[model samples]
Target: MDGDIYKIVEQPLSPDAVAASVGDPAAGGVVIFSGIVRNEKDGRPVKYLEYEAHAAMAEAKMREIGAAVRQRWPSVKAVTMLHRIGRLEIGESSVLIAVSAAHRREAFEACQYAIDTLKQRVPVWKKEHFEDGEVWVGLQGG
Candidate 1:
């Protein structure tokens, strides 16, 4: 998936690394957003985060999102998205989004859209480890 939008890796995520990985000269603006494992959520202490995914489907969905972004925003230059798997301690990056566009607005919008769509559509799930226990999220049963 060279041209595809999604990437899954067991290694650590870095903003500068992602920036260097998805560089396009046609774009004057590049935007990157990183979602980190915070110490608290809903006023509860979060110790760590563990992520899992249906790798094949997750990657395909990410590519679809990238294509949709390009189609919706003609000015979009390039897109790069990466999600980490396995256990991550507090303050670690869970998701990274990189977008390049002719202007800032397109980049911002595309990046936001990519992350939002991933959460809603992608088959990735996360388990939050708290001081008391752990709970797996994103599995809304019928």
Candidate 2:
């Protein structure tokens, strides 16, 4: 919606592709954020991460974030938000966000806002698989 690229995919995410999606002639700068799965979390070794989401609702929320960014930073030329679902190995990118704007400040700020809002508002959930067990993130004491 609103000509922004927002989607939830099951395949591995590509930061380059997501960044390219927001390329625009009017944009003087582009900013991208890639959320990667680390080898450890809270001092525990992590085996992998599995992500799930209400696809339709997640996309809708992402679109809302894009709209909010545009409204806050009118200089933004384009925005792209892509999140990968399914099992993800350590070092793999779980989410990618790209924003293009007339200047670097707008691009950077909007990109930051996009990812921050996404984590707090989107319906996506992640399960962290540790060596001994797995726990759904965001649960109490998880």
Enumerate clash totals for all models, in the order shown: 0, 0
Candidate 2, TM-score vs. the true structure?
0.96
Error of 2 at 33 (Å): 0.3
User: All candidates' lDDT scores?
Assistant: 0.85, 0.92
- All candidates' TM-scores? 0.92, 0.96
Can you write out model 2's per-residue Cα lDDT over 1-142, one digit (the tens) per residue?
Answer: 2568899999988888877888899999999999999999889999999999999999999999999999999999999999999999999999999999999999999999999999999999999999899999898574
- Model 1, 29-93: lDDT tens per residue? 99999989899878989989999988888888888998898999888887888988999999899
- What value does the lDDT take at residue 93 in candidate 1? 94
TM accuracy, model 1: 0.92
Which candidate gets the maximum lDDT versus the true structure? 2
